[model samples]
Target: MKLNKHTVATRYAKAYYNLAEEHDCIKEAFDNMMDIRQIFGENPGLGLVLSDARLTLAQKRPIVDNLIKNFPELMQNFVLMIFDYDRMGDMELIVDEFEKLYDHKNRTILAKVTTAVPLTEAQKTRLADVFVKKLDGKKVIFDEVVDPEILGGVIIEAEHQIFDGSIRLNLETLKKQIAK
Candidate 1:
């Protein structure tokens, strides 16, 4: 049976969320995941270390131990589970999905804006305000990214929604209209 990445990610993320809920450590899980992602991102060598399945658990034990310092018990359990499943490469993806699940449970909706250039403070505030109004009862967490691919204007993405209004998008729309 082939496993789809999103389904696999959801399964692993949900399992961790369950453990976190039992221990009242959902926030801890989120923070620990963020920390782990940063560690993996900053030290690409960790991937090589984790991928060596030939290394005995005893040999790999120190790596896991030293890497787990101050992590919550739930995260420690998650780490152990990953090691058991040989899914350490998917840790970052798992964390991201876990965060989405966690936020869903908490009624937190994240909104991301990508534009060709940095948004002015007033523009960011107004954009967030508009999304907040549209997503009433859910917290609108805003993230504005600068993407040259956008050419101009903004691409707004919220939980369950995407509003692409960039110049690049408009050009594509115009091209489609002409073709039709």
Candidate 2:
């Protein structure tokens, strides 16, 4: 039986999250993971290099060690374990799963909001307030996107739901109604 990437990542992340919680270092672990994710993002080839079959664990140890030298002992061990298990390629997925656990623990929701223009701080606050109620009071964090193609109104995607109130969509609806 072959486990998928997500399953492997979730198992590792859940175990890591539990360990961090036990050590009372969840925040620190989360911060370090975010930084590590950024590092992976900035260096797209890092994962490939670490996962290369030609490079033995001894050769990859120094690189991984140097990259995470400043992190706490828990995180250091976690990274080493992942590397030791040849799961370096799934580091990003692990980080993402860890983030989801962190957010759920903190009662936070990440909403991707798209609008025709940039929203003011006031608008953002109001939007968040509205979504907060809809989301059963989870603190809302906006990932704002500006797309002129929407023409007007807003489109919100969060928690596997999409609230598309864009003018373009409304116009299409109207056109269909007229045709009918």
What is the TM-score of each predicted model, taking all chains together? 0.78, 0.90
**Top candidate (lDDT):** 2
Clashes of each: 0, 0
lDDT of 2 by residue, 104-148 (tens): 888898999999999999999999999899887579988989999
Winner by TM-score: 2
Deviation in Å, model 1, residue 174 alpha carbon = 9.5
Poorest 10 consecutive residues of model 2 by lDDT? 133-142
Model 1 residue 151 lDDT?
Answer: 96
Report the CA-based lDDT of candidate 2 relative to the real structure.
0.93
Tens-place lDDT digits, model 1, residues 13-102: 998889888888888788888899898998886756776877777887778878886786668878988877777767778889988898
